[model samples]
Target: MPPHIRIYDVTQNISSMLPVYPGDPGFSREVLKSLEWGDPYTLSALHLSAHAGTHIDAPSHFIRGGRSVHEIPIERLIMMVDLIDSGTVVSPENLSGLNPLAEGVIFRTGSLTGYLSEGAARACVDRRLKLIGTDALSVDSSEEDAVHRLLLSNDMLILEGLYLEGVPAGVHTLLCMPLKIEGAEASPVRAILAPAEWHQWIL
Candidate 1:
């Protein structure tokens, strides 16, 4: 157990009050049965997209015949992670801080614009970063989103649309799990971080 790194709820609202993408289905709440004056219990239902909130896009999201959310191996999703608080995009040369990019990475971009600069992408991917998570909305099509694609092409997990504010920049325990939908392209997830106090157990 790491030193309780106080994980905040960074996920977006998934209720009727949430703002949906244009043309996407608006969140809905309905009482299938009411528990009011006479009824005993109330059953409420919801309608939303798997990619509606902070979510994980499975390989099926891009390459055809890729594994669905349920089919992905756990090795990629649960590896060690290194977080970077690089204000926004960086020049091709400034990525030295992320040297030795063998572990997974979480970029703290602070926005959901969803761009993917090719140079930065190549550096991480070429060095075999196992997974990539971004606070941005998308990791492709911004400057040269092909970087995201390059990582994804190697069976890497691409986590986007995350809102990781206040989460410190260091090694932390990531309990990131996606919804299990058979054969679905992606699924919404609940990502949490606990401080890295692995030293505690080592003693």
Candidate 2:
């Protein structure tokens, strides 16, 4: 086996304590069987929104007749990613000088106010990026619909609610796999980042 490279988990823990979007179902677990009750095994049922925690948004999330979670190509989920910290607002100016061919771009927005302007979203599409990700819950809280439409219409995947607190800004190999829920618009993912050199070994 090849030597293991360091990996950073960018996913948030799905638990009752984790926050959810307004009106979205919070994470919860109901025990159906328990060892405390002398049951043969412990089994629990989880209840949460598909967008809970670290998740990928299919085009169908905003566009009618768009591709669903199961329809997304796996190649789009794993790729080279540019991790950029644009603070609160990711404007077009923030994206200046970036590699135009990066398969994915992950914004490490440290605050809830962090979001992409419509112009920035267009820039991403113009650069031919296949995916966009952010640590924030939503890319544009004010003009969310428009922003989402701009990206999704261009066949760009959106990853939201990433826990990128300590991740460095650089090119990394992203390995994010969402559940293949048929006809679902979104699905939670176990997102991770590793050195770009690890890509070949991982594949």
Best-fitting candidate, scored by TM-score = 2
Query: Scored by CA lDDT, what does every candidate get?
Result: 0.67, 0.87
Among all windows of 10 consecutive residues in model 2, the one with the lowest summed lDDT is: 93-102
The lDDT, on a scale of 0 to 1, for candidate 2 is 0.87
Off by over 4 Å in 2: 1-4, 200-203
Write one digit per residue (lDDT tens) for candidate 2, span 1-203. 98766789999999999877777889999999999999999999999999998999999999999999999988778888889988888888778867554688988879755788888999898888989999988887754578888999988999998998778888899999999999999999999998986666766
In candidate 2, the residue pairs with backbone N, CA or C atoms under 3 Å apart (3 or more residues apart, or in different chains) clash, namely none
- Model 1 residue runs over 4 Å out of place are 1-5, 8-10, 17-23, 90-94, 99-102, 142-148, 197-203
Ten consecutive residues with minimal summed lDDT in candidate 1? 194-203
TM-score of 1: 0.81
- Candidate 1, residue 78: lDDT: 56
